[model samples]
Target: MAFPLKFTLVTALLLLAACRSDPIQFHTLTPAQVGDHSRTTVGVIQIESISVPPQVDRAQIVIRQGNSGLAILETEWWGATLVDELNSALADQLSNYPAQSGYSVRVDVQRFDSVPGQYALMDVKWRLRSAGESEPARVICRSTLQTPSGPSIDELVLAQQNNIKRLAALISQAAARKQAGCLMPVN
Candidate 1:
């Protein structure tokens, strides 16, 4: 009886070890190194907020299908929370500008959808306010950056990185225009 109990305990331990999975690999998105060489000096642009939907705010990558179904990839995760990663990427992207001027930016991410082997889509509403301005300028930007995923999560992450780069470019352009007094007041 003692031998049987010991064997059962050893079997359970072996099964538990076998069922253990390798640690999940985490990934991060980085800002593009390219800068606007035309501008010698850029203003201080502060990121006020970066908000995402609850489904995508967590560390796990959320893949959505149509309107209802969604899958959270447990094996693949962001290096940090999605919002933090985005904030870091955006701040890094804007760091190329000179810090002479002052501007505040706020972003509301409506959709951050990724489809393996297909495309990555990002739709965002953003606001920019120059220092001392009473109201901010608002814009809606959307990008359906496409890349052959090769059925890999790395490719999906790459697509997301590209989309973020595009968004940063748009925001930079807007900031340049505002700095140059090219943009008229919406009101």
Candidate 2:
């Protein structure tokens, strides 16, 4: 009787342990902290539309394994779809920029890659159109931003946030101009 009772308790304890799992962690691309600066802008500078690659648009955080492989982390997720999170982050940062005039910006991401212990990269083709300007007056430009990362997913996320913030800065600076020139490279 004693042995049977001990066996039942051990089995129950094992089952309980098996039921536990690693908690899922959600992350966002938004600024980690709000700044002291005002959130209002002088003129309208809206991010008209931004498109991300379909491959990376999922809720799970997908990372590069090597040159040709990718890994989707089930326990790591974005707060929302990747595209929505990215747009929100950019909009939040761009809303504080002072524009010479109203401008609408559009970005189409060509590549977005995150590698643990490596780097985060964003290559995008962006266009800025002056408010009330025709399509022919718009100037399209491209920028590729890369940030170094440490060995952890958190570091990769931070690197990607930096990349997005840099992209927003580039957009804000280029939107201030109405010429038909491309954006200058940023170091």
lDDT of each candidate versus the true structure: 0.72, 0.83
lDDT for each residue of candidate 2 in 1-187, tens digit (9 for 90 to 100):
9999999999999999999999999998986665575556668477878898888889999999878998989999999989898889888778767677788888899998999888999999988887665654366888999999998888888888898888878877777655557765465
Once all C-alphas are superposed, what RMSD does model 1 give against the true structure? 5.6
Query: Per-residue lDDT of 68-137 in model 1, one digit per residue for the tens?
Result: 8899999899999999999987777676554445777788888888887677777777776665557555
Query: Residue 95, candidate 2: how far off, in angstroms?
Result: 2.1
Q: Backbone clashes in each candidate structure, one number apiece?
A: 3, 0
Q: Give the TM-scores of the predictions, in the order they appear.
A: 0.75, 0.90
Clashing pairs in 2: none
